[model samples]
Target: MSRCVLLRCAAAAAVVAATLVAAACGGDDTPTDVVLVTHDSFAVSKAVKQAFERESGLTLRILQGGDANEVLNRSLLTAGDPQGDVVFGIDDSVLSRAVGGDLLEEYRSPELSTVEPDFANPDPHVTPIDHGEVCLNVDRRWFASRHVPPPKTLADLILDRYRNLLVVENPATSSPGLAFLLATVATYGDPGWQTYWRGLRANGVRVVDGWEEAYTQQFSGASGSPGKRPIVVSYASSPAAEVIFASKPLATAPTAAVEEGCYRQVEYAGVLRGAHNEDGARKLIDFMLSERFQADVPGSMFVYPVRAGVPLPEAFAKHAIVPRDPLQLPAAQVDANRDRWVARWTEIVVR
Candidate 1:
């Protein structure tokens, strides 16, 4: 889910940029504030924010740059002169764009050693921060009441019995949507994936602009919303969010993730190229990897921290399902095919 947020373009005079360069080159003193530009889904706890500020002696300013795609696109437009010191939420699906554009400074946080080995990036410009799985979430109660079995895999989605029961976000506009699209691509080869999508279109799958609409307004599984569709494309951790945010104690979550066809999405943070506060930016990246921030990640953003051995929240531990074998596509393959795939997908499914 993303809301359009205005990004302030960096348009300072060359003299001003040179002054910043001089300050960065001659600095022992950290800047008073460090800006973090991230997607709308980014969140942090007040305690963690305060702790980082106290420890680093700098204020952390976060700017929401719509969704992951928007954030990346905006950063590319201002590559050498970024709008913020640090850019967060560059995920595996679109990482090559950031790296290829030279939008980030090369400064691998020492904290990278603490990250899970699977998420380690060979690219030196960014450090992994958090990860999540995008998969189908079914309304358990909806199927139970109707005496119908819930869908368990991508192959089941196009069955006649489940017709018109699923809602998905548009891949061109949403991160989870794009992940789901990539999952299909990984599951089925290029042409085969197109065939599967044709089946989905024939079976009456509905599409929305983003996750918020599909999950909150169209998907019956979501908490406290009267949505008609029984299944939605959303995060594997969404079930935990339901349990954690429930109005009253419930025995179990109403929704559950379908492990098959799940896609792993690992997000990263980097120091923007030519930032005014390079030292502060690096410290902020370190703070994100620290246990204090990592511990708060699950509850705040419904995603798992990349830092190894950080304890999960009780609700998340009990409800969120980590896929045994989540699908993945090489960053290079995805970067090369993303636009073509999205366009082809639109023609087949949307148009």
Candidate 2:
């Protein structure tokens, strides 16, 4: 294995994010200390953080690192001792494992009314915070230049002309990577996904470690120079992000999403089981699901708001689309099959 491959296989480090605590000012015991544990993708502006603090009287400290599974694993493995007051960014793919650890405190926020029932944590162990669409992304200019129509379906990718033009992140180490793998499972049931993957392997596919490398290193549109690969396994909103981050603003993005096989990934937030302050922790969870926080999701986390009626920013609103019939698998079922899926996927495609 190459050095990069070994790095991708290494166990993820524990991530810590956001701290809040109760601080005494004058005679009132104000809620001041609250710790938020999240992955590196989680983001919030200073103004938003200040709004949360003013609204709830809590000081925030964010500790962050690792993939979603490792974050949840570190939380579960040390459940007896515990770290941080709340945990966010556990997607449904790993939802079952987080629940299995019994490290979640139940606080069925009335906010469940605002979230889609399918994504709501029925056990009340966690609350869906936001969602993202895992879709195939293509470099519009690259394909247009080659006169090769961008693939509209996953199967279209196996055409001889398109060999090695697609890049996928390794599922074991990246959060979106896991979602993309689950998407295939949802689209092609049981052993069917393995068959589909074998066909792709015969066509020659490229796999990377994470979205950062896939998008920035491998995707032709974002590599700062032309890349050999044009398609990537990434969030649907990446095209818009590319436009926003470009050196010269383009009227339209150079990339687009193939929604046919897209997967819906719902991110969740919850109070860690051994939280020091249940009251403050519940308040934090509620805060995340509130309208103000939902409105902040797009720019804050580059994810769609879970709560209905939250208007998105122009950049995202213009390019991102929620796919119809986007693939979904039950969290419990995913938890049960995760290890098997990885083994089968690696067996078929990692050669």
Model 2: how far residue 215 lies from native, Å = 0.9
User: Residue 278 in candidate 1 has what lDDT?
Assistant: 91
User: What is the C-alpha local distance difference test score of each model?
Assistant: 0.90, 0.81
What TM-score fits each model? 0.91, 0.89
- Candidate 2's residue-wise lDDT over 1-351, tens digit each? 998877655623211111212132222444456788888788988888888899877777787857677788888887846678899988878888887888887789987788665565466788888989999999888899989899998888788888988888888777788888888888889989899888788887888888888888888877384567888898888777877777897788888988999999888888888876577788888888888889988887778888877888888878767787788898789988999999889988996
Can you give the lDDT of residue 59 in candidate 1?
75
How does candidate 2 fare on TM-score?
A: 0.89
Best by lDDT: 1
- In terms of lDDT, model 2 sits at 0.81
Task: Count clashes in each candidate, considering only residues at least 3 apart in sequence or on different chains.
Answer: 0, 19
